[model samples]
Target: MKQTIPGLIAAIMALSSCSQRTTTTNHVKVKENPVNTKVTEQALDKGLFATLKIKNEFKTGEPVKLKFTVYNSTDSVKEFCKWHTPFEPLMSKYLEIKEANGEEAAYQGPMAKRMMPPPASSYQKINPGDSLSVDVDLLKGYAVQKPGRYTLSYTGQGMSGLVVKDSVVFHILP
Candidate 1:
């Protein structure tokens, strides 16, 4: 009976801690001011990550296809909202694209106004050591008119607790 009591207590503790999204840590605690949490993008879980990839180059007015993948390297399953991601139709401009001169490419896609805590249908699940990918054409959303090198990244909060590594570069020909 004594051993059973300790095992039960441990089980309860594990279950209780599984559903929490925020934790208290000196530099990583949830901020009292919501505005300060904007920088929390840098504080996302390292276990879940996103990456952007593109082809070598593109011609002016050609399709600049982008391949975005979300990887779950942890032992547990991870989930993220697919609303602002490429898994859905291009309804919102969630990508940040910059020209070679550092000017942001204008977003020419439709803008969608959403409510907080998105609908349950907007979520996607990825299992451990698995990845989900979606390919989208940048030309359909952002105005990639300039013929030069450009950097593309997933800056949207689609996958709630993951950081997107901005390392994709592509060039456009005149």
Candidate 2:
């Protein structure tokens, strides 16, 4: 019976983990357009990681919407500056989108001047195992109206205090 207890506990733990699924929970950053969306990212390291969620496809002229989510996977709370992320009003473009052929989309947004040591208002705190998300219309800052497969990633040239280690790829159907 010694082995039976441990085996039963492990079985239950496995089943519980398998039951959890991606969702738009109360922690949802925004719900401007509540279409079905799911976790589109996988972590590249421990501590904190970022993910971009987008539809697998879109129609030309339609809003190429994106959801930027930052998850804290560690046991402690973490905070970071929100600059260059969708968490704040986007004055400067922060994403680099490229076509399948490696052509980069042009930026046509206004760039804002930030004061040294971004004010406390510019930071966000995420609790352990919790996530924060924000919605941004990709087209608002980038000229990406063409219908084609495009890959989007954080430029890493000063995009928030956290690094977006993962990216997402989607297609535009004309």
**TM-scores, all models, native as reference:** 0.70, 0.70
Best candidate, lDDT: 2
Candidate 2 residues 1-174, lDDT tens each? 998999998766543321212322344232232222332334323345677788989898889999888776655566666777788887887898999999999989889975555566767777656688888888888888888999998863243545566678999998
Over 85-131, each residue of candidate 1 has an lDDT whose tens digit, in order, gives 88789888788888888899999999887654566676677666567
Q: Residue 157 in model 2: shift from native, Å? A: 6.6
Question: Which residues of candidate 2, in runs, are more than 4 Å off?
Answer: 1-46, 157-159
lDDT of 2: 0.69
Whole-model lDDT values for every prediction:
0.68, 0.69
- Model 1 scores a TM of 0.70
